[model samples]
Target chain A: MTGGTAARGPLDGLVERVRRDPGAIGALFPAVGRTVGRGPGPSGDPDGILGPTVQDEARAALVSALAAALGDGAPDRLAEEVEALYRFGDAEEKRAVLRSLPVLPDGDAASRLTAGLLADALRGNDPRLIAAALGTPAAAALDDHAWRHGVLKCLFSDVPLDAVHGLGDRADAELGRMAAGYAAEREAAGRSVPDDARRLLSLTHGETEA
Target chain B: MRIFDPHVHMTSRTTDDYRRMYDAGVRALVEPAFWLGQPRTNPGSFHDYFDGLIGWERFRASRFGIRHHCAIALNPKEANDPRCAEVLRTLPRYLAKDGVVAVGEVGFDAMTADEEKAFAHQLSLAAEHGLPVLVHTPHRDKAAGTRRTLELVAASGIPPERVLVDHLNETTVDMVDDSGCTLGFSIYPDTKMEPERMVRILQRRGLDRVVVNSAADWGHSDPLATARTGEAMLRSGFTRDDVDRVLWRNPVEFFARSGRLLLQELAPYSGGAFAGNSILRAQHAEPDA
Candidate 1:
């Protein structure tokens, strides 16, 4: 949940299920194990179109997998619980979760936590998620995220021409056109965007796409 | 969590500025004495401005448990005022005083000869005190000016690790990195680097020796700029380690190099003795959480 990569092993997958799913959510130290075959089930859509029960089922699956892995022998169960909540529980629970992650550091743990948080940060301009990711991710994970595709290509890659990735080309030559439209809309309402933004000089305009 | 902004100015901000920053996660900010939007008059105004950075503003931040730190300097923008420049001779004395961290936000604003001259003097002071220098570059013709600033830093013989090239834009980061100094990018709202753009740039440059700042002063800036950059980096699919390097370890290392205060388990503090103090009473308090 804190900004760091958290490797969710098959064992961890089971524990996540036990914690959240009433089916497994309330298990009293249930014995679980990883078959080592399947990857994580779908995270399920974040939009909440999935009903509450379905969400709980998915959570239970995650909890079950988690319990099977670590076996609850580890101390600091509260911290682990908080980290899970911070990562998967809800938006508001992150801050409380982050305050605890800094105290515990294990191998590949921070990075695993970081990957999920970084994904969250990349999704929006949220501060809490940013702080957690900033505080927790493993060094290598941080390096990977910091120097991502387009940027990585421009700064470190041997070929500057092929650095672009992720950003889709929904519309080519659309920036200038859309910028003009935006400018026109603003003028109609007697408003203004900064000159650079109005002129399509925004950094987002890049090589292509609106 | 407690935060010390390490850079900001409140003279040009409104009450809303304080409120929003407080809410957005800024617990403390360091205001380096610098040039205002325009020129200034007698020492009294300058005194008040410095006062705000260390006095009024300090109180304001502490109200939110944000400890305020001040870096007194003759902003490069005002270096042209020979009468004001005369004050430079006295700045070092203040630089040696309490709450002063690495004679800065002093650097080339217009990249004017006067700015260069002032920068040299400040650098000398930083070296003299074993303090790190926080260098602010100009906003226009930035790449050239950043290069120039680096050239002069080497010319002045200031150690690269002891300098933080601030206000960096995408065009200028290379110059900053090449200088072997730490980079400080300001994610100003609507004015400077946008959050998304910052993520893009970070992706290109590693977080090993760089930091992100809001530089939110009189303009429309977000005090939570660093955090915003963190978020954008994640959306860009970066992992957690990347965000931590840039926001936490990097800045912590920079401040340690600044030869300022040492902090451990520090959190935000919004109250205490941030008012008119006995000059003799000035003492570094351990950072609190």
Candidate 2:
């Protein structure tokens, strides 16, 4: 596919493939192994470049295709598929499914259904998974309280502030207050506050400190 | 064993990294202009960054006896920001500077329309300025991004031989090789290709027009990765001549096209102070008179 077309239509061809033979989704697993484990030799892996590993790229492509194909279907049905993928998949696979949450049709319903997964991811120590959950378009669907907690979670976990999308737009008095409280607690314990936390707090007050 | 780490972000690195790199036989290096982790607000920020790359950063590297060169361009990730578009107008002046060698770290990130426009414009700038181009392929969607990069280079009318496409892995190597552009592999830690894997690639592909770099940036990366790769090559039964070809000769050949590459050994710093003043504020205290 041309670069122009690929950016414009990320799931265009993949949706048809998933719809035509949903059973073929299982094939992505082995393809992931073939592409990820060893070199593709001189021919090169056609499925490569979604990420560092073939597994990551394949999983991301498959999840995105499945989400798009099943967008208009019954909400519960789509949730079940996502749940199965999350449960049966590895850490990278789970990350792919979480990242696909935003691109799925019916953004509101998808965000609602995946809130638990996002919450679970935020509670984890894996920076990439947390980054995936926060960076997604679905992350925009987070309610004020959830979003505030997500920001705090990132600070407490040492994830970079850049991982949080629309940070400047979303900064508010409440987040600022929370960040100050976090900073004070770190100070009381004789620890330095994260640089991003300071940046986040500055953003709440509309100051360009960084 | 003298090496030229053709692509690295020494701005994000520490002076100790410079010391280690110098000790590892890295006599010269190039720090490409790249995203500074945070989104810069305007074109003025880019001008300041370019100035540092040419001025302060060069002096700092000279302290460690490493000749510092830099490539000036709007990085691909930031090209999409309209606020920074004015940088294109500001690039020609910096591109002509002494330590500047190429118009680089330029290519697709998200493959946005704005990115393509900036990339094409910079390629033209490289041709007009009589310099080589350093292209960074997207970390995500790398294959299609690389194909598009080559297509754009072909369209830009800059000969493929004058471009060095960096951050390539095993999957994208063949495409870059077939295109006749110089191949650049960033042997970074976890995210990019590893040293052992890089050795295997060199073993298979042979070190013709290939350059290996560390690309050590602000993130969790090792500045000594190029030296580590050289060590790996030797461990794998490759000759020191093979290591030298990939690490030094290939990069020298690529950047020499610009007529700006200075391969001469620079004199090491004679005085302990930088610019006639030491960072230490006071002399050692005399004990009780």
Against the true structure, whose DockQ is highest? 2
lDDT of 2 at B182: 96
Candidate 2 residue spans exceeding 4 A from truth: A1-210, B272-289
Model 2 / residue B209 / CA error / Å: 0.6
lDDT of each: 0.54, 0.75
Span of 10 residues, lowest total lDDT, candidate 2 chain B: B280-289
Maximum-TM-score candidate: 2
The local lDDT score (0 to 100) that residue B224 gets in candidate 1 is 73
Q: What lDDT is reached at residue B54 by model 1?
A: 56
Candidate 2 has an interface RMSD (Å) of: 17.2
True contacts kept of each: 0.00, 0.00
Residues A9-121, model 1: lDDT tens digits: 64355555554542443232222211222222233322211111122233334433444444445434533553556544443234323323443344355445644444433
